[model samples]
Every structure is written in C-alpha cells, then in structure tokens.
Target: MTFNIAFSEVTVTIGNVSVDGYTEDIVVPITVSNPNESVGGFQFDVITMPTIINISDVSSVNENDFSADFNIFDDGTARVVFYSNTGEGIPAGSDEVVLNLHYNGMDVLSALVDLEGFNLTVSDADGDVIAGNIVDGSVTIGNVVFFSSDIPDTGDVLEQVSVDISIQNSGLVGGVQFDMYDTPNYLDVINLTTTTRTEGFQIDFNELDNGATRVLLYSPDNQNIASGSGPIANMEMVVHDNAYNSNVGVNFENITITDDIGGSYWVAGVDSGTVTVTPGYIEEPHNLQAQDGMDAQVLLSWDPPYGPIPSDFSEDFEEGVLPEDWITTTNSAQGWFITQDGSSAFWTVPSHTWYMCSNDDMADDDGSVDYLITPGLNVSGAQNITLNFASYYDGAYGQTAHVLVSTDGVNFTEVVTLEPSPEWVMETVDLSEFAGLPNLHVVFHSNDNGAWASGWAVDDVFITFAAREIDRLVHYELTELGQWALTAPKDEVMSRFGGGLPHNLKVDLSQPFLTENRPVELDAFKVYRSLNSSTGFQEIAEVGANTTSYLDEDVVNSTTYYYYVTAIYPDGSESGPTGTVSATPVEW
Candidate 1:
C-alpha cells in the first residue's frame, strides 16, 4: 500500500534595498504567497555578508494574529519564527508581508541576502508541511574614493610636480588616509596640502623608507567634507634627475576613509598620474654668419635653437578615392564622396582637383546626417596642435556644417561651426586642448535638417604641431662708401678709401615667433670670433636678448675673420655655436 500527499506551493521572497550610505535601520519585507489559505506558521533564516550589512531586528506583520521571535547572530544572520497566536491561519494572498527584517549598513558595498534553504519551513493550520520556494534579495551602498585621471604635466629634470587627488562620496567624510607610491627611482614625494574642498581639514604625511608617502587628513572640529565630487587634496613631488624622457607614475595604496562617527567606508577605485620629463640640455643654434662691412668691421648674427614645424598629418584627397583608413557614416542616400566635377549648382565646390563633398542637394532631405572621420592619430607627444582645411559651403534651407574632435571614436565635441560662404575659404582651428590625446580623431559633419540645401566641400586637411620659435637674422647690408665719406675729410678718405675706413653693417632679424612647446627664456646673445674657420673661437661681445647685430669694430682692414653666435639662458647655459661664416673687412 502507498499514500500520496500534495503540499501547497508557497513562495517566500526577501525584497531588495539600496541606500546611499550607512543607515541605522533599513526595513526589508519578507513576502509570502500561496494559492491555499492555510499558512499558519513560518520559519526562516536571513543571511548576508558580514562586512556589508547586519541584521538589527525583525517584526511580525499581523501582530494581533501572529507572534514573532528572532535571534540575531554576529555573522550577519537573523533567525525568525512566526506562529499563529490566535489559532487563525493567514489568508491566501500574493506577496503579503509576513515578516519585516531590519538591517544596518556596515560598509560601502553590495551583498546578497539569502534565505537558508535547509532551515526554511512553511506549515498549515494542522502543522502539515507545504512546498516552499525561495527568492533572494540584494543591498547596495555607494561611496567612492579615487584619484583624478590624466593629471599630466611637463617638466625638466629635478623639477617639482603637483597632481590632484579627487573623490566622490555619497556620505560626509571626516577623515582619510592613504599610502602613495611613485615609479621607483623616478619621483620622491614631498608633502600634501588641502584644497578648496577640504579647506579647514588638518593634514599630515610621512615619507616611508621604501619611497612611499603615507598621508592622513582629518578635522579637529568634527567638520565633514560634503558629499560631492572634486579635488580634496594636492600632492607635491619632485622628478629625479634621471627621469628625463620618461613618464613617471604616482599611485595610491592602503587607502582608508572614515565617517564622522569613526566608522570606516570602502574605497571604490584609484587612478594614477603621469609626469613627463623633458630633456634638460638646449639644442644647437642655427644659421650663423659673418658679413663684410665697409673698411674695418665684421657683422655677426645667428638664429636660436629650434625644431621645425611640420604637419603631423595631412590629406589632399588627390588619390581620387577615400583612403582605406578613413571612415564615413550616413543616414540618408547620399554621403561624403570624392569627386572632381561639381554637379550641383547650389554647392560651391573647392578648387582642388579631388576633394570630399557632402552634397545635401543630392541627399534625401529626411533629416540627412553625414560624417567623415579621420583615422586614429597618436598625438600624445605633440604640443600646440592645430587643424587646417580648405572648405566651401553656401547654406540654404537649414543646412549645417561642423568640425568636431574626439579622443574616442564616439562622443565627438564640436570645435568649429562653419558659417556660410560664397567661395572656398581656409579654416584654422586651435586644437591645443587635445594635444596630449593619443587616439584623437577629427570629424567633418554635415546635416540637412529635413530640407534641401547646399552642402559642404573640404580639401587639404592637415593636423600640425607648433614648433619652437627660432629667431634668425634674415637680411644684412653694408652701408655705401658715399655714406661713410659724408663725415670723412677728403685727404683721409683719399688715403683710407682703399682699406682703412670704419665699417657699418646693418642686419635685420625675422619677426618674433610663437610656440607652445617648452621654450627657453633668452637672457642674451653671445658673439664669438675666430681667425681660423674651424678653431680658436673667442667670445668677443655680449648683447641683449633682443639684439640682432654685432659690429666687430676692432677688425683690421683686409683681414678675414670667422664669426658665430650663440643664445644664452638665464641659468648660464649656452646653445651650441652656430655655423661659422668668414668675411674680410675692406674699403668699398
């Protein structure tokens, strides 16, 4: 003989909860559901991560009909038992709260609240067991501590560097402590100071033997850093002399954050900063020369040390087709196309033999959007970048053209919005803000907002980096013999006209140049002279930084002298001697 019994299907679920920070009491309902109205008693255990949350108390939903008893454990568990005190079973219902579990957030984290499978029980009025299903819940707490990203600064060897330390806190912060480490042998931490966000906080730090800096910040008056995001502290360090041409990193470890009540919070993330150290020595000077002057002088001039300004990237679209690396996207029938012939009367084509054009007149007018993007360019080493292109656009019927930039392929930012023009015009856009980006991309965007209009044409696109300015003497002329004779006596002029009269040399310098790279300050120009072309050069005179010419009035007529010039820095550093030039002083 065999007997079969069917149990009612009852589901007991724990509800999810989320809070911004630590809370004294958070209520979570334990709901029950069944098709049969025979639930008389229930028992279960709620378990959570001990480090994230703790169960505080439990209560019965129907106090008059049922009585509840709960036991809290130190390991973040609560055992609850509910019984029908009036001998009346709970009515059949969907998602009815049978028990309320209270919890206290322990840290900034997320944890699962699970029902103990082996300890769960659901019984009917007569104490018969019923089939049960369990559903778990979760709790999340929010507070984040991190360093600012891309904190980049350029410096020479043995220079001091500073970087910001930022945070995002959901709750007030009363204190913080962390250990900062730098790239071994590259940087040494000095100290830290409070920023505007932590103006009145007390700060202290100690340099450890292992090249790590341990820092602590707190408030003596129980003041709290308001919950928000910004820099809280600034760290100062010095780059080692051997760190030249290197990108040194500063990182954080062993971080701890505390609230006003002395409870510790979890650190969400951390980021490092990079210090780029440039070479310390100056480059060699260029374009040195000595020019002959009337009768008895040799004029010397030279250009400063400089790097050439060249286009880092350029495209003329003369290949008659789009390059394989470039990309195009469109939402309508027409998009960017390479063509030599201008077919639309409404569009003013560029004068290039081949160019890219987004013709709105040919595109479907249903809100056409088109984009032409360049390949990813590594411009991290470039300073003072710029974008230049030849463009033609005659707008009509709500059409628009824009030049955008992006570090990532997505999420472009408009750098230039083109105005309507009747003919081709050259456009230059300052891209200095994006100079240190590695994977930068340029976008040419066009849109016809649901109406037909003239389109945009572009050619000769270029991305360039500004070079260091090098001032040079471009022109030099010797004063005519008649000018020198104006002040000379007839007998003296007659004797010195062939070889012995004084010389006057006039030299002109090129216009003052500008650059965004590391530019050295000019203290003065040092002029040097040599009787031989290759050796025995001696410093003859020193002139101001703005000086362009030097007259060697001690020269003897008919004697050839070699000369070169160098730029001097305030730190007593002098550039390499410029190219030597030889000239002989002679009567005109």
Candidate 2:
C-alpha cells in the first residue's frame, strides 16, 4: 500500500509512584513521518514500555509513558528511529501500560488502541543506591565495569588469590590483579596460571595490586581452574570497561589465600580448629569424596555438614552456640545416605558416580564439574507435576522447576513448572490427564536459567493423591467473584478455604444453618444461642479462623443453639458461604 503518514503530538503521563515509589517523569516522544502518500492527523497509543536506560531522557519528554514501542504511521517504512534504554536504570517495569493515544489525531495516528500502565524500578545494589525487590528490572552500565561478586576466601586451600565475577561491559580492558594485607597475610603469585574456568565463566582476572580483582571465583594460585582439576572456585568478575579505570582497587577482604585441604584455618585469628575446607571431595580420586559416600568404594558414615539449615536460617542462636537443624538420614555403614563432606553433595549409593558441577561445568558447558548443593533439597511430589521441591531460585533469573515424568520407562515430557521455591506453600497440578501418567515413572527436574550456577533440587516425590477435603464441593455457587475483596457488610461469603487442623470447634447440630454457630472457614464464626431460627442470634460464640472445629462443651441442658465457622488465610484473605456449617446443638 503506497501511502504517507506523519505523527505530531506531545503528551506523556505517569501514575503516582506509591509502592516502592518512582522518581521520574518519563514521557513518550511522538513523531509522525509520512512517506509514499499524504495523510494528515497523527494518532496513537503508548501500548508498552520497552527497555529504558536513561531516566533523565524520559523525565524531559512530553509523553508520560517513557521506554515503550510506538509507531506513528501505518505507511510502513524500513528505515525508522526509536528510543531505547541502556544502563543501570531507566524505564521501570509493568505488565500494565501507560499514556494512551493521549495525543490529538491531527498530530499522531495509530492503529493500536488501548494502553496499559507502566512501572519502573532500577539502580545499583552496592553503589550509592541499590535495586532491591527486583522483579524484571536490569542493570546496564554500558561499556562500564567494576568488581562484580566479592572475592571468596579460599579459607585453607591456601594457594593463590583471585575470584570470578559476572561482568557487563563494552570497553577498553586493563590488567586485573590482587595483593594480601594485614595479619592473615598471603603471597601474590608472580608467575600466575591465569586460565579461564567455564564456557561463559572466564575468570582470568589480572591481579594488579591488592585492590579488587575482576574475578568471580576466588583462588590462591592467582589463576583460574587448571586443566582437568576439580571444579574452579569462581565468582562474578568486575572488569574495567574503559582503560581509564582498568585497575579497580581491592581491600583487606579481597586478600584471599587458597588454603590446602587437611590444614588448620583461622577466623579472626581464633582457632577454627583442625578443619579441612577443600574445594571439593570427589570419590573417584581416593583423595576426594562426596559427603553421602556417593562414589565412595568404602562405607562412609554420614555426618552433619557445617553451616545452614532451614532452622539455622530461621533461628535465634546465641554467641558461641551452634544451631540444631541438620538431620542425619543414615548412620549405618550399609545404607545409602548423604554425608557432610567439605561441601554439600548428592548421592545415596556407592555407585562411584558422584560429581558436582564447579564454577566451570556449572557454567554453560566448559566441563569443570566441581559443583555442590548447599542444604540440598529433599521433598516429594506426584503426577505430571512436582509438589514441594526446595530451591533458592535465582530471583534475578526467572527459573522453573524442570521435572521429568513418564507413563512408561522410555518416554518423558518435561514438566515446565515444578514446585515453587523457598516457600512452604504447595503448588499442585492434575496429572489424571496424562496418557499413562498419575501411572508410573516420574522424576523431578530443575531448569537452571544459567544465572545463579546453583542447580535446582528435589528430595521426594510425594505421590500422595492430594487427599482433598472429604466431600468438599467447590461449586460456581460456592465460588464468589470478589469474596476475598472488601465487600458490603452482608456481601461476604463464609468458606472453608482456610481449613486446617483446627484445635477447637463447637458443632451444635440443633438449629443448623443460621447466622449463629455458622462454622465458616473464613474470617470468623458467629455462633448464636437461640431456641429456634425465628429469633435473632445472641452472639454466644465468637471463634476466629484458627478455631476450626469447635466443641460445644458449654451448653444449657435441653437448650437448642446454632454455630457458625469461618476461616482466614494468613494474608487476611477471607472466603465464605455467608452460612457455612450452621448447626443446632440438640441433646441428641
């Protein structure tokens, strides 16, 4: 279609920044360019915000919706210019859009109607300002780089010093190096064995002085992992994008020495005791072994791995006292159980097939499998879906639990959504639809988004067909549209949505089905004491959701009273039937 069109309008809008708040007046710029044919009047909407990098550019714009894709003309043209963000922070984020065809038709033209809201959140976490509670935001310090992850203290592998870091840049490079300082002094290897670790993880950080080195995994040998050794200990690297600042300064903490395993270590000069903190403990190499005796040729009784536990993480430990949470599954010399080696491991049998991916293999593919799972997961699930798998899902990278299920031993459909991570909540899906599934073979999977390098885990497959609420009926009638939403005084419904192991309840089977003694599984239960439904309630019982099933222990002899129940989910989430389980207690 040969035609011409142009856009001419100036308008931008931003909703009030409340939650977490925004501090910019990002605007959308409209430009109508008519080629091929002549068409007047520009009209369009700011449908969605694209990757925004500069907030200042947006703040000065006339349009409210900043980083978004907007087309001014219908007459298609191969040549076009548009605005986009690049570094640290810019256009925040939002599933919603902002700034519709707020411009007049005379200046802008658009076929796309209806726009949504836009949200933005950005900044540096370590610098002056840090981006926290990040959802979909990203850091884009273009052509600029700094130390990424902190330098790891090799503790006792006392060899060289350097850490790997995830760097983001487009610039001139400089020499990367390190140095030791103070009492816990170490040597700076002059002739370094600078080798890159994994495929994507190249931690050849050149240690210049004692300042921060652009390394991800730290080591004492002043080099990356050597050929075919265990996995390389690395971290994200901070590179100098510009020659002006090629050498970033390191600090005392950056002075790490790769300690040799089987040696004593010091913490704040205090004796950490004769502990062996090796990079790994593989089984194939008589010198290395996994905690669970995974690849061990001999029986290795499992012991408690130091540091971290669900309780230890969520506990109140005093000075000098250790926490009690790590549980041992097996103490026998014959049974399969994970052991507490230098690092966490996965293996039950002595199959001699146990290895963890190190910073190398753990990366995309450069095969250095010295990996480990810290406080590794151990949960259960059922069907085409997984139940409760534990994982520190890299919040930065959208990750899904990779799961494998098979009706027969040969075929497998990768289940995309595994159990939710780092939470006690349960995510359940129906597998009754599987061709042969809800049937036989099933295995949990973890889809590593390739960011954290930390693998996903599964402990158990709880194939316990969800014992649903017995005889519970969730009819459309039972499901209220906005029952949970704040409603008019009498608009709320009473539901058993929060049905849990209730400690107390009073079920008066007498005048059932009334305002009183209405055992609702919502906010609360309003129990009434009346001889009949004809009279109003006497507010005899006031039980909260925590009060699941109540016991009508106190009742007048030969008296008839009704009861109600209500439940409240922890989120102050309310549900109901308005007349949950109403019963009249008769001396039956």
Candidate 3:
C-alpha cells in the first residue's frame, strides 16, 4: 500500500534540534500527510531520527509536513512517520489524511569547529630560507587547502617560500562561513563579497552588531564575482568595516616581511604601524644675547625673546623680561624715555643708532641730542650691517647726532635729518637701503662742542642679525600593537591639546630615544651666535628642554652668525654642537 497525506492547513507544527545528547525546540508549524489506508499511529521519533540533517534530508518529504527547528551552529537529526486514520487495512493510492509536525528551535553553529595552521621559513635579503625558524605566527581566516612550493627549513617566512593549509567548516551552522588566510605578512582575503571575483581575497566575519544571523564576506578591492556565490546579489553594503582585522586581528611576527627594510614585519596581524617622527632635542630655539662696551661707559647689550620659547611662556609676557641683547641704556642725566615713542604709540622704534650730525663745528655752541634707526622699512632679502642707537646733535660739531649707514660703512650714506630735541628723544634709521649687501657697518661720529658735547644720555640699545638653519625629519616605529603619541609634543608644541604655550612644556616626540621604540628626556640646550662671525662665536642663550630653535637679535647685518643647538644630558654631558641655525635675522 502507498501512503500520501495532504493538509488543508497546518493545525500545529513544532520543530526542534539536538545538542549535548538532548533535543531542543527551534522552529514551528509542521504539517503531516498520509495517503495509504487506515493505519493510524504517526508521531515524532526523536530517538529514530538520522544523525546528519542537511538540505538533502528534506528531499523525500515536504518540509511543511516534517519541518523541524535547528540551531545554525549545531549538528541535528530528524525523523518522519506515516499512518492511516481508518481501521480498514493497507490500501493503494490512499490520499486523504493530513500530516503535520511541531518544532520549537535550532543550534547548528555551536556544533562546528574550525582550525588553521601555517608553516613559514624566514630568510635574509638573499632568497634562502634558514632552517627551523619557527617563532610566533598565525593566520586569521581558516579552512585552507594547504599548498607550498618548498618546505621551510628555519620556519621563517623565508624569501620566495611557499606555504599551504587545509580549510573546512566542521558542519552546517548559522552565520558560519570559510576562506584561506595567506602568509602572515601577506595575509589577505581571497574571496570577493559581492562575487567570488578573485582579484583580492575575501574575508568573512560574523556581524555581532546586527541582530540578523548573516555572514559578512569582505575584500579590500571592489571586485564583483560572476558566479555570485558570496553576499546577496548587488546588496548595497553601507559600511564594510575595513578595520575588522583590527577587531579580530591576524598579524605577522618574527617572519621577514617583503618590501620592507631588514627586520621590518607586519607585526601581529597589523596592516600598518604608527610611525611618528620629531625634531631632536638640540633643535629647539635658544635665546641669543650679548653685551659690548664700545667707546667706553656706553653699556650696550641686546637680545631677542628666546626662540622656540618654552610653552610656559605667556603671550602677554608677564615675566617682563627679554632674551639676549635686550639691553637697557641710561644717560648720565637719568633722562626718562617711553617704550613705544612715549605716547604717539602709532610708530614703533624699529632700529636705531646714536651719533652726532651738526650744522656747524663751532667752539662755543651747545650740542644737540639725536639718534637714528629704521622706522618704515619693509624687505624680503638678505642684508648685513644694520644699526640701532640714539645720538645727540651738536651745532659746533655740525650735528653730532647725525647717523649714517653704508654697505662699506666707510662710505657713509645720510638717511634722515634729525630735528634735535632740546631734552632727549628717540629716532630710527634702516640700512635696508643697501638691498642685498652681505656687509654693512654702522659708525657713531660726533663733533658737538667740537667733540666735547656733554649732557647727552643714551640708553636702551638693540640689534638683530638673522641666520636661518634647516632641521631634518626623524620617524618613530611602533613595536607593539596599540596606540601611541608623544607626551611632550602634546604639551610642548603650543597646541590646543596643551593649552597653547603655558601647557606646551613637553614636545610629544614619538621617538623611543631613551628606550628603543620609546621616547627619552633631553636636558637643556645652548645657543651660539656669530655677529659678523669675524669675532668667532659667542654664547647667546640656554633652555631647559629639547627646544630645536634659537633667534638671537644681537647679530650685526652683513655678518654671518652661526648658531648650534647642543643636546645636554641629565648627567651634564653634551651630544651636539653639531649644526648651526644659518639665518641672517631680518625684521620685515
């Protein structure tokens, strides 16, 4: 007798799967059908179900009639029975009984396991793999068909060596997928997400963020597969998490990575490392200052605010201090003077020099006080021999306060005519008129009272010479997997992260100076200056950090000043007097 059952509609269907020797419910709504005669004892036989339940298991009967729940991660089994409602014996072509089964759930994924193994051989620049070179190495995605051209002798990812491994999913599981993970350093996905397009490799992952039991396949390249065996056909992926490798990393270890200098590695599955470079400690700006007592009792000193100034410095300059050559002048008469032209405040005394320029060289005439300095000057080239000072005018000496500047100094060029102030006033003169002259000289001449002009007070003299120098770049390599940054550059670079100056005491240099792949603390630095350099070099400034800059205003125009930043260790030892800052300081 043949049996066939059709249901008008499923009254109730329960589905289930087995795990750890027990049956668990996974799904529902199973229908039953019997077409053979009056045989009537049909029920679910959990013990009699076949061990393996795959898509092929539903071939003999309609899934609606004997459907059972299953875990995408678990291995399960199922069984089906037939019966007749009438007591009449077996009959052929019997077909009026409804067949249905009920199921609750499934667990296919928890029932599977995957494993991968990689065999590598390392080598030097030469393409020879050393023997027995196994250290720490691993592959991310598993289920490979292990293949290798040559076996590694040293276990290193030896040059031009081949490696292979077997890949397989233990069984059917929900959201479970497979692929090959290449060499540690060259470990790339081989399957395309959209298609099996093998341009780049594909990496599959479980989407923990999404509630759906979907397997995610990815490839670095945007290639489409013709067979369309991967992701949903043309399912627009909004975000592909290229950083998933970061989440469930696969990295390279001691194996020599291709295309990098010796010892370079992919390092524990990382795609790229964070390399930070920074200026050495000796490159910071140091204040350059100096003092000279020329022509007696005229205490003249000059200096600019320190270069690469410490972050602790405030913009408002609360310290009320200046760098080297920031000299304060005094007249034997204690004559008072203002900072910015006393009150006009509109004009700033840029540069100046003291001298005598008179209308007459008489014997019985009172001398006038005059000074010269450049005021409205703008330039963008190299220059030397600029002057800064204040002088008095003497009628007997034909204007003793007269000032002059020339490329040769001996060949003087008159700049501005000074209207001698009865008391004492300030003035400026710019030697920038000489354009690109590498040499400029400033001379102080006075015939006031026939070289006897008294009561003239000179104070607050300043000079600036620039010599710009270039610095090199240094890169830091990250040894381990994680995040890194310079603790100093953060607070030392005068950035928002350090709250501008006050917080920039440290330069976040990513160099592992003290400790390899780490950073070290450098002591203070000294700055050197050569005003004309004809006088060798003089000490200009000193700082307490690895400041790589220095600007000394005590330099003379046309004079080449060579400055060098030396790295001083905490033990008071110095490392570099190495290079100089070759800038001819110019205030434009």
Candidate 2 local lDDT, 1-588, one digit each (tens): 433212212222323221111212323332222222221111222222222212222121323323433333233211111232332222223223322222222211111112232222212211222212212211211122232334344322333334433232222222233232222222232322333443332334445464323332334333322223222333322221111101223233332212223111111111111111232111110101111111111111111111111121121111212223222221122111222111221101111112111221123332111112122222223323223222222111233444445554345565555433221112333443443333444433333343332233222123334322111111011112222211212112123313211111211222222222322223443334344544554654555533322234545534434332223332343322122112222322
List the lowest-lDDT window of 10 residues for candidate 2.
282-291
Worst 10 residues of 3 by lDDT: 291-300
How close is every model to the real structure, measured as TM-score? 0.33, 0.18, 0.20
What lDDT score is found at residue 228 in candidate 1? 88
lDDT of each: 0.69, 0.26, 0.28
- Which candidate, 1 or 2, would have the higher TM-score against the true structure? 1
List the RMSD of every prediction in angstroms: 27.5, 31.9, 25.3
lDDT of 3 by residue, 38-104 (tens): 2222323232122322322212133333222322223343344433223332232334323332332
Candidate 2: stretches off by over 4 Å: 1-398, 408-410, 418-424, 435-439, 449-452, 466-588
Q: Cα lDDT for residue 448, model 3? A: 43
Q: What TM-score number comes out for model 3?
A: 0.20
Candidate 2 has an lDDT of 0.26
